[model samples]
Target: MRILIFGAGAVGRVLAAMLSPHNELDIAARDPKLSLIEREGIFVHGAADRKIWPGTKPQGIYDIVIIATKAFDIIRASESVNEFIDENSTIVSPQNGLSHVDILTDYFGHKVILAPTTIGATSTGPNSARLVSLGMTFIGSSSGDMDREKTVAKLFDHAELPNNISNNIIGEVWTKAIVNACINPIAALAGVPNGTLLERNSLLTIAEKACYEAAEAAIVNHIELTHIDVFEWVKEVMRSTSENRCSMLQDLESGRRTEIDEINGVLIKKGESNGISMDVNRALWTMIRTAEGRRLP
Candidate 1:
């Protein structure tokens, strides 16, 4: 199968390396990055203990396009993939945040599969990614058809990426949203890895409270996520990914725009639309932006 990955970032590169062994893999990204990967194959460092780069262009009409861009880049990235995607093409997004599936569905129609990956890998340098935990990755279609979803499940399974298909994808996405609501901004604000706050009662309380507010907002939108349902999942993620800093925090450190506008900011707007208040999430969003400004010219 011909596979193309958009955004060649940490997650994209990790998927490229993992999938390249079994299928033909091609990666596309903006600017010098793609040139680097195309000219010298993708260089992966840290974790997995192997520096392997697949040296071939994916031929024929791409069968699957996996998009792993930041939430803010979803629209442009999806549009860019149109050249390669066809009627049978399946697009999978392992992006963070809630609006991504809807955004891709709007652009690529119902052929898209919504995936939330906790296959913990971090990018330590340009064109380099480290495999950390390789947790569960879930997939399903927004339209609830299982054909494409199952195809993706078996694809990842064949590649040893550890994934499954879910009928309750909205709940699954929102569950990850709840975890991101707590971990991403808090990690950015504290400048610590996600697991660091697990021992800090003060930070843990704040995080749990934020998760509560997000869960309530999601429920009001008919999203059906219960804090009781996702509490242990959240705790497990924190414990497992304790040493890694969130991508948002990494973006801030590198003087790039964080996806706060999509994650926390999207939740705030959703809450307002539902007559609910997301003051805590809003406050963290503001603080994150403020901190981001300080790193400016």
Candidate 2:
């Protein structure tokens, strides 16, 4: 199979290393990251270990096009890879929020697949990514095409990525978004690792409240989430990736734009538009926005 990963960030690199051995792959990245992979190859450590040398860019249509760019950068990434998508191409969205999946649908139509993953990994460097927690990667179709989703699931299975094909990808995406909504903002503002938050009752209380608010907001919007216990989910994630800093925290520290708007902001907007209250989640969103303004140029 031929695949193209549009962005080579932590998630993209992790996918590249995972899929490279099983299929012919190409990475769409720029400068340091692109050149680094071409030179030293990609090294993944921690939960999973693999090394991949991306030799050259492949030509022609690809079977799979995974859009691993940040939520804010999805448009640019989608546009840049538009020409590479053919009728049979399957585009996957492993993004953190709900809006990005819609944005991709606008650009690529029904080819867009919402396949959010709970796997925790961070880019240690341009060519090195460390797997923090090997969470389940859920693949589901927003367009209700079970066959298509299962086909994508096969690709993941071939790559040995822990994944499941779901009939409710939207719920999965929302569930994942709320989980991030619960931890990301607090973790970023507190300037602490994920594990520290779970260890402290005060932080856990804040996360639990945010989770409840986000869940209420989603329910009000007519979205159905899976029957997973969110508070327990948050605790398990914290324990799994104890020392890991989430993407929002990483972005703030590096002065890069964060995806608070897409995660917490989504819940806030839904609550405000529908007369639902999302106080705790709204507070987290406001604080993260203020931090982003101060940190980014």
Candidate 3:
């Protein structure tokens, strides 16, 4: 299989390294990082450590194109690789938030797959990454094609990546978004690791409120997510990634724009549309945006 990972950041590098040995893998990166990876290959640490490169810009339609870019970059990344995608190519979005699948499906139709992953990873530098925790990734088609979902699951399994085929991917996607909605911003604002949110009663209270609001919004939007208790799920994630920095916190610390808009912001928007109150999410969204604006030169 020929796979093109559309970003060389933390998640992308981890997936690229894991998949490169089994299938032909190519990373679509930009500028200095692109040049560096082309020259030195990708260096992966933790879980698996090695340098590998399937090459770049190879001619032919890719069997699968994984969009591992941040939520905000989905459109630009999809457009950049439009030529390499065909009716046969499956585009997998392993990004956070509920909006990316819609964006990709608008461009690629039924070929888009919603992949919600719990795998933890952090970038040490450009073209380099470390896996923090191993977790299962759920794969399902945006159009609900069970065959396509099974195919992706098989591919991921063959690559030794943990995966499960989901019959209700939208529910799963929104569930993950709900988890992010509660934990990410609190972790970002508290300037603490994920475990801190669970450890501190005050922080945990705020997180619970956020999750409740997001859950209410999901219900109003007709999204079924009854499989797991939201609060317990959030706590489990916090415990599993106790020392790991949530992506939002990482972005804030690095002075890079976080995915506040897509995560908490999306909840606020959906809440309004469904006539549900999202004051908690809205406040967190505003706070994160304020922090982001302060970093501007």
Best by TM-score: 3
What's the CA RMSD for each of the models?
2.4, 1.9, 2.0
Q: Rate the local accuracy (lDDT) of all candidates.
A: 0.81, 0.84, 0.86
- Enumerate clash totals for all models, in the order shown: 0, 0, 0
Error of 2 at 17 (Å): 0.6
Give candidate 1's TM-score. Answer: 0.93
Tell me the tens digit of each residue's lDDT in model 1 across 1-297.
788888877888888888888887777777677666766677655555545465334445789888888898998998778888779999888898887878898898878888887867777766777777677888988798789998899899888888878878878888888888888999888888889879898888888778878887888888866346565667789999987777888888888888888788888888878888788898898898898884311
Candidates ranked, most accurate by TM-score first: 3, 2, 1
- lDDT, candidate 3, 1-297, per-residue tens: 989899877888888888888888888888898888998888888877868965876567899999898999989998988888888888888899977877888998898889898888777888788787767798988687777788789889888899988888898899899988988999999999888887899999999999989998988888999355888988888898887778898899889999989898888899888888899898899899999884321
Ranking by lDDT: 3, 2, 1
Please estimate how well model 1 matches the true structure, expressed as its whole-model Cα lDDT. 0.81
Q: What TM-scores do the predictions have?
A: 0.93, 0.95, 0.95
Alpha-carbon deviation at 179 in model 3, angstroms: 0.8
Across 232-262, the per-residue lDDT of candidate 2 in tens digits comes to 8777778877788888998898888899988
Which stretches of candidate 3 lie above 4 Å from their native place? Answer: 226-228, 294-297
Please give the range of 10 consecutive residues that has the lowest summed lDDT in model 3: 288-297
| Between candidates 1 and 2, the lDDT winner | 2
Compared with the true structure, the alpha-carbon lDDT of candidate 2 equals 0.84
- The total number of steric clashes, by the backbone 3 Å criterion, in model 1 comes to 0
Query: Which regions of candidate 2 deviate over 4 angstroms?
Result: 55-58, 294-297
